[model samples]
Target: MPETTYSSDASGQGTNGSRFNRIAMALFGRQRDKLQDPFYLLLLLGFISQGFFWENTVVPIMLAALWFLLIHLSSRKYAINETTEILFLLLALLISIHFGRTAFMRSLSFGNGLLVLQAMRMLRPLTPREKCLSAGIAIVNIAVGSQMMLEYGFILVLAAALVLILQTFHKLEAESCGFHESKFSPRAKWKEFSFVVLAMIIFFLVFPRYRALSSVTTNLSIGRNAPIAPTLDPASGGMEGTGRLIFQISGDDIGYLKTFTLDTFDGTRWAAGKHASAFKRNLRVEPKPELKYRKAIVKEIALLGGSLPADGYPVALKGNFFQDDYVSWQGSIRVSRYWPADNNIYEYWTDLNKHLDADSRETASCLKHPELSDRAKKMIADTTAAAAGEYNKARALEKHLRDTFTYELGTYDLNRLNPLDDFLFNEKRGHCERFASALVLLFRQMGIPSRIAIGFVPVEKNEIGGFFNIRDTHAHAWVEAYLPDRGWLVFDATPVSDRVLQRPASGFALTMRDWVEFIWYQKIVGFTSNDQVMLYKFTAEGIDVAAEKVSRNSGIMILLTILLLALTGGIVIFRRYSAGKAGRSSSITYSEIFAEHFYRDLLRELASAGIRRVPSETPGEILRRASIKIPSAASEITFITDEFCKIRYGGRKPEEDLHDKVKSSLHAVKSAIKSRKTFATDLH
Candidate 1:
């Protein structure tokens, strides 16, 4: 026996961190990957999916990952206590209360709270049965998170989760069958997933979307959540925000969607005015014409803060949402209550034609601080001096600002007593905010009713879906001046000079992303029972149309069909024939292998008795040699050799007597040798 010594290079990663990592991996890492790796990844993905609507997702995902790591790395001596269950109960209660109190926070408080609970359950060690239960919990977490918000993100997350979930079960099945270190093939994975995906697609097509459990495509765009209100403050925000799609507009009324008008200037920023109707101010509500002069625009939009923008006169705006939940305030639409999460495809007769009534003239004219700097007041008066009436005066002021002021997105001083004065007098370069603010103030001084309107101006229409993809960069501010003779007229004072124009947002990557989102929204999230019926109809109609077309060209179609069938039959026959040919050759069966094992053992036993057989020696030669070396055991050797030859080369099958015959022959040989030794010792 020798004591072996082993040494390797030290230093580098082989230090404490590496040592700990090695120890950790040896003790607690993937153990041949029996579903734990995929399960853990699935857990994290389930939490991450909620990030679309839930703000508290990152913390839960972090907590789950940290706790998972610690639990696996340690000995995991702990178990789930009654206290843990009680904590989960208390959390659920609090979440229910929060949901009741803040109804719109469905995805935020409740969805994230459930995920955190699932994460906390992983604090203890998990047995096989417990692991199965944990998998069920993960499913719940995924379902909870997914149902709260259905977006393109959730679709992606669910796709990944599906793969992981299927892998986890596959591993479990392998482990059950004693194949602990099962090697999963990527090809097999896709093959298995195809069946599941096909099943899911069929289910989605067949199942009617129940109103009680319908999901919503939430407004998760950062562009949608940006601070949209006007603030004349020196905010250090980016010049242009992210290019994420806020929403999309598909119709001809694809111009500016007025959200709200900034009525009063608190000097630093313009505050949104109270919700008031055109009728409240003694204004006539324009009826929707029987024939829309401008073609009807149907829009599918998702926005935050209950703001669903409708264009033009808001008298005849029709949508799939509750009429009671929405209100047309000052030509803008606002969802007064929680969204119904029901059918929608909102239609607007919006022509981008804005009009204000005589009743709003006085309200729009009033301002908080009309006293501008002396220079600004003088310049504005001189600019409008040639204007005859209110309409001319307002146009004159708008033209003056649009012509003279340079459009630049620059931060303005919030604390300045008069930002309008700064823009007009010192720095004439400003964005639409400044230009629109300057015009509004000048109109107020001239005894004209004007207010700043902040909304979006869509410029690029998607070439794929033919919809206007609105991003935060499309946000604009302009002025709406009231005229007693005509109506409220639109005016934008932001000059087009020196502004960076964006290239058409059309590329392979962008087109694909938009296309995926469009499908998710239109075909997936917004899918209804009606949609299901329509899908069936569409499928049936498509088949019928295709069949009709083929019938019209029956001669060519029959020839093509026959060729296709022959080709398919030939391919199938070829594959089967190839498989059969490959399988024809074979090896020894289990019984033959057993017989060979016995023959080899017989030779080894004789060699151990000091009658070693040469590798080249045949079984018969070896048996004879062994008998000659010990002549007393000649008959016993003869019987054993005959039996082995019969089975090994004579094509005899193993039988019940095979074991007994070999055992008895070997015993008889050993007895003969012992008897011979005794007799020879006596004679000596």
Candidate 2:
């Protein structure tokens, strides 16, 4: 207070501190210069890739265009202003509304809303926080994809996405450290990252999983414009002849892919009553009927209908989300919920040749139908008149329809009062639906329990994959008649010539793609908890069998062990003999000779002094400790020990003259130890 004088030194120090603070801020503080980093583009591409799995094409296309524009803007260093932000926000709002409206109009589901949000987030320049958000969204997208489609291609994509995401974080850390170069090489970083991915896979496999209760009820409508339940409505328009792929079937033999069977014919449309309940109840309580089963794997490539398609008489099904959605009864399965459009893999154990004795209730349900027209009644009576038993009667009706009717598409009488009657009497040339409907009604009227089954007939087997590639064009209807002793036997009244038409052969590339997809579905996607248990049991049984065999051949095993030990000893002795011969030659180094002789001489001296070196203790360590008891020869002991250590561990090649010096040092130490032992004996 008295002087109040500022020093030039203090002022200079203050100025320097302010400059350092500014530099630190420039390095570590949040950057506001760039709109977004180039690494974020990898995240954008990953997000865009997931859209291909969805049915929405417009959203993905728009998002892709927007992303390209953003990348262009970022490359040109175009800064986003308030106007740009507002425009992007408005565009996002419009897209959301359009998506919501389209989803509502078409009755389509809006799955995890991340895809839309990711697209919107990509529109603006991202800060560090926003980049982190984008990375998280990309990770979630990969996780969602794994659940939807567990293909090997998808797994590869997921791995790439993870690497890109990690690289982005690594770049962020570099930027924070004020370094333009990466801390680690890309190859090195990825090698370390591979372990992390391996750990994640291990956790996924070993962690216990529980089925989450699904809250969303899928619309069980057959198709976009089709009925809720499968109907044999001959009044409906002709079959969809599009050759678009619907599903794939992998098994030994292909057959009719049966979904639902309709029993009640209400004069116009054939419908199943309480079909969902019937299937669920039958599967829950009933023992799988005594029938031989052939296992098949089915994968939905495109959405065909609401219910899951399978061969007739599915004994069991393996899938992910819709395990409880389906019910099985009377050689048919009815799904209560709609299937996802992509990667819905299911394994079916079906009785391809089902033989069952139907209960009274099932027989009655199949026989019950609406009032039949006199024309229909007369036709049924005539067809089954000459036939003896129910089986023969069903076969007779099936043969009559096949022989009399000709297959024609888009020839249905929509306005007719009785579609089946029109098909049988007037229009003898109709699709499989008409023929199947006629045969089913005829069997019912003849006191034979029968139902019409609606599903695809997998006739086109891929030569490369050895599996059937079912298409929408293959959607067919057939009859299943209940006999006296045997169960419901599949009776397709559709003409064999029409049903057995040759399908267009698949190209090599397409066939190979299908083969890869089939392997993925069978080995990876189809592996369930039951399969895991089976694998565990199989491994344990193998171990037990191996142990039992070893025990049974105990004498042989002991002889083998002895022979192995003898061979190993002989090899060691041969190596030592070879080394000895090499040493006897003048080519042996001085260090090697000194190291061997010095170690053996030191051990012998220590033993004479009644202080033998233990096996666990090294020569150098023993000499150092022994020096305390025999201090007079400490210097010589230290020199010899150092020489041995250099030769043995340090790989040092001493001069030939140094070998003589080491020998002299060992001699002095041995004489000192012998003199000490003699003095001790004289005192005793």
Candidate 3:
């Protein structure tokens, strides 16, 4: 029924600005000086401005800051206040410019800019408008930087920037009416801090992420010129291995990296090798089990972010890599196009079956040759015929080569005429490339469609993500001889030398980096609609129908989701109702309730009467003082105040009559203030 009249004594506009200057200087770890508060506030404002808005206006603001710094520097010599602000602003501008354009350099620049801006504000603070500008720019930097290169490292920089922003601008009001201590009061400080943290968390969790970066981005051709004619050597870019180590594949068995399949073999080499036109064409291969202990190590290959091997080929064997409409086998998994650089991880599987197959034996012997001498050729023919029907002739050849030749790497210059001849006749030793090639030719001479395959065997494995690290040094050549029923049987002719598969010390770090790179590529850069579907499927776990429905874009799933949400809501509502019914009612009397109303009215009356109570003041004291000022309402006000105190302190019952009386008393107090014209005159 009554509006409370409020008043407060005109409190002196405290020199809060000076106190802020001292506190800000203390926080920035700078020596106390006249300019410190201004500088610190500038830095704080810069951060706020950057985080909230990133417009060209920031440039002018920065320029103004610079001009101020310059003036301060000219006037004050060697003072921390002046020098630091200049340095911070200059550094921030430099970092912003540096990372503003280039992709690789952007993260560093953006992070530095935040630090510089914050430091600058700390050194020479700005208006609230400027603080907002800085905070806006910070948001732009953080949002863009995360999309470009989101790493845990960037997270750390963001946290630091947030802290700097708080220290610089938290106490400075938008009005810039020389800082106020109440603004930094512990309660307010904590409240602001909590709000900032909550905002950052929401930004982090809900912000939509960009496509995953390419795993192959790590192997980006950073401005390197293409070679005129690359050689087949690992050192050359042609048949050369990727200098960047692809993640390793390892288990109990080693696996080979599949390059493009050469179906068309020329007399001297396996050439263009056209794809077997018909999908049903099966080239038979088989290896006897009795000769060797068996274990098929199937490698699950995820093509990370790099161009598919130079030749576009689907990368995995049928029944092993994937079963999908798009996949087709050409002797090997091959794609007609290179994998895109938008880092994608394509899953492929390969069976690593251990076997000393017939083809393997023949490969060892032939690889030991230049172009099999007449004697060597005859030996191969005889071995092939002796074990013709069902026995193993390849094994015999393998035994002979093992007994005679030694394993060696890098004996002959590749440019030399008939390099294989040099290895076979003069050197009598060579690495897998020379050996595998020779063996393949020898096997072909004996009527086997054996050919040389080049790629690295995975050597070391990363523990964190189980990635195989296939290095340039791991580049190897092996043989694949066609068998009758099983298709092409794989065989390695390289002698198992301890040094051959040396795991470099840097391999572990490189592997870990590759795994991270892989994540970036598949999740960000190479994320296709297909990948999204797969991710949804995987998240759905192994429910095939669910996966199929998801892949097919079945809207039935949406209905299911809605049903699930409704059921969950119904359950929650039921639980709340059931809990409420279990004797959970709450009740309070009228006098007890009136105490709250009386307290608020008393505060307003005192404020109008030119003696506003501080936020922390108690009710009894205000009532006692109000009674002294206006004796006419003293008894009534004291009765209300005493009852309010009793209800609050002693949990006394609040009555309806008491509540009505308190209301009447509050109206009378307001009328008294107005009659004396206390509400109208003091504020003026």
Clashing pairs in 2: 356-487
Residue 34, model 1: lDDT of: 24
Roughly what TM-score does model 1 have, to 2 decimal places?
0.51
Q: What is the lDDT of candidate 2?
A: 0.63
Ranking by lDDT: 2, 1, 3
For model 1, residues 445-536, the per-residue Cα lDDT tens digits are 77767777767776766677666666667777788777777777788888972244354547878887876766666557666554575577
lDDT of 3 by residue, 251-320 (tens): 3343465442333333334432323212422212232222221111221123221112211122232121
The per-residue C-alpha lDDT of model 3 at residue 88 equals 73
What candidate 3 gets wrong by more than 4 Å, as runs, is: 1-137, 150-152, 161-208, 212-254, 261-373, 382-386, 389-391, 394-404, 413-422, 497-499, 504-599, 602-684
Best-performing candidate as measured by lDDT = 2
Model 3 global lDDT (CA atoms, 0 to 1): 0.48
TM-score of each: 0.51, 0.52, 0.48
- Candidate 2: misplaced stretches above 4 Å? 1-216, 219-224, 227-229, 235-237, 251-254, 274-306, 315-318, 323-331, 335-355, 359-361, 368-387, 412-426, 497-502, 518-527, 531-684
Which candidate number would show the highest TM-score if scored against the true structure?
Answer: 2
Instruction: Quote the lDDT for 218 in model 3.
Output: 28
Q: Once superposed on the true structure, which residue ranges of model 1 sit more than 4 Å away at CA?
A: 1-21, 25-138, 148-160, 175-178, 181-189, 203-253, 261-307, 312-325, 337-454, 461-473, 477-555, 579-684
Model 1: worst 10 consecutive residues (lDDT sum): 291-300
Cα lDDT listed for each candidate = 0.60, 0.63, 0.48
- Across residues 1-684, which tens digit of lDDT does each residue of candidate 2 receive? 132432224234323456654443344232211224436656555556555434345655665666555544443344556565456555644654555433332222222355555555555556555666777766765554344344466676666766677677776645433334245566767786987789876664555233222234465545544322356676665654667666676665556677667777777887765642365432333225353333345444225454566665566665643535455455555555543423455555666665666777777788776677898888878888999988887888889888877877677465567676667777788777777777877777778888888777777777776777776677778888877788768898888744454466778898898788766665455555655665677889999998999899999989999999999999999999988887666434655766877777877777778778776655545765778889999898777776666555444566668767877887898889888988989999
